[model samples]
Target: MNRQESEAHVLREATADDVHLMLSWRNQETNRHVSKTSHEITAEEHARWWSAVRDDPSRRVLMYVREDLPCGVVTFFDLRLESPRSGAWGFYLDAEGLDGRGETLPAWLGVMREAVEYAFDGLHLDRLDGEVLGHNTVVRQMNRRFRFVEGTPRQELSDGREITVIPISLARTDRRQR
Candidate 1:
């Protein structure tokens, strides 16, 4: 594949129109399973969430655009612009794009690279934090590749199953060294 096709993901600020699409991706079986809360969300619930965050300065919900298609989403929440200059982040790809396709891994990597740059350089944040389910080894590895240092694991219940959530953090200096 050409370089552009191989690494063409872009992150755009999500708008109100993206609510349904974001919900669809979030509610996918695989996505839900790896999430802290595995239950499916209703339209009403999603609408409420969208409304709450759409105008919030402390949160940013972005969509990953690849070849003009929105293939994933990345979000930064709990932004502290004062003393800490940090935020928590999460991301998920479109389920349809990840069905044994050869593009999934590369697409994910490109999106993550862009997301981290946006977090540190574009947003000028001191640190970014992420929490992944312990069972989601792929994501855990990806975070490491991006220089996120793993922290103590926290136990959480998801769909009645007790799972471990691994916390990871990446500082601005970490990205600078990369």
Candidate 2:
């Protein structure tokens, strides 16, 4: 992938038009496998979830764009926009779409970089946090590359099964030191 093209990415506020696409991505088998909620979400469920959080001040749902092509979704929740601003973030990419175009790796890396920038710079957040399944070592390594420190692992019941969750966090100061 061209360096310029890989870096040509942006994050934009998700709109009503993106609801379907977001739902499709979220429901992808690969995505659902590692998610906190592993079931295929019904249209009604997705609608309710979107409606509840779309305009909520404490949550942000953004569309990830690479070279003008919408390729993923980024979300920030549990946002505390006060003096010690902090939030938890999560994302998922259009794996099938990007893979067809041979842009999967670049898009994946770009989304993370842009999301981190958005969390700290665009949102003026003091800290950022995320949760990754223990078995998802690839993503955990990626998070560490971005200076996110991993916390203790905890077990949570999801879709009738217990899953190990590893909490990771990055502070504004730590990011700046990169």
Candidate 3:
């Protein structure tokens, strides 16, 4: 993608209309394989989750817009709106859709860039944090490229199996240095 094309990608607050689309993306095999909770989420369960967080002040659900089309979702939760503003974030792309158009890689990189901008600029956060499965080296490397410091990995039981989870954080000072 060219500079203009990359700049064209942005994010908007997700609305009710995008719920099912987000669920579909989250349930994709590739997404599920890497997620802490890999079970397929039922529509009812998804609805419940949406209901709980839709109007929450501490959480933000954003839709990734590429050329005016929504192709992915980014979510910020565990938000602390006080002096030291911070939050945890996660995202999933419309892999099938973007892959068909040969835009998957660009979208992946673009979304991370936009999300970081949103956290530090739009949200005026002091820090942003996230977690990655230990086995997901690509994401770990990508997070590092964004200047996120990886914390020590910890083990967790999920889906009846033990998995290593790596925590990562980026302070505003570190991001500004980038």
Report clashes for each candidate as comma-separated counts: 0, 0, 0
Ranking by lDDT: 3, 2, 1
Per-candidate local distance difference test? 0.86, 0.90, 0.91
Selected candidate, larger lDDT, 1 vs 3: 3
Ranking of models by TM-score? 3, 2, 1
Model 1, range 19-131, lDDT digits (tens) per residue? 88999999999889889888999999999999998899999999998878888999899999876689988999887666556668877887888789888877888999989
Candidate 1 positional error at 148, Å: 0.6
Q: Which stretches of candidate 3 lie over 4 Å from their true place?
A: 1-7, 176-178
The alpha-carbon lDDT assigned to residue 3 of candidate 2 equals 63
Model 2, 1-178: lDDT tens per residue?
4567646788899999999999998998888987999999999999999999988999999999988889999999999999899999999988878989999888888888889989988899999999999988888888888889999999999899999999999999999332
TM-score of each: 0.91, 0.94, 0.94
Candidate 3, residues 48-167, lDDT tens digits: the string is: 999999999999999999999999999999999898899999999998899999999889988998999899998889999999999999888888888999999999999887899999
Positional deviation of 48 in candidate 1, in angstroms? 0.9
In angstroms, give how far residue 93 of model 3 lies from its true place: 0.4
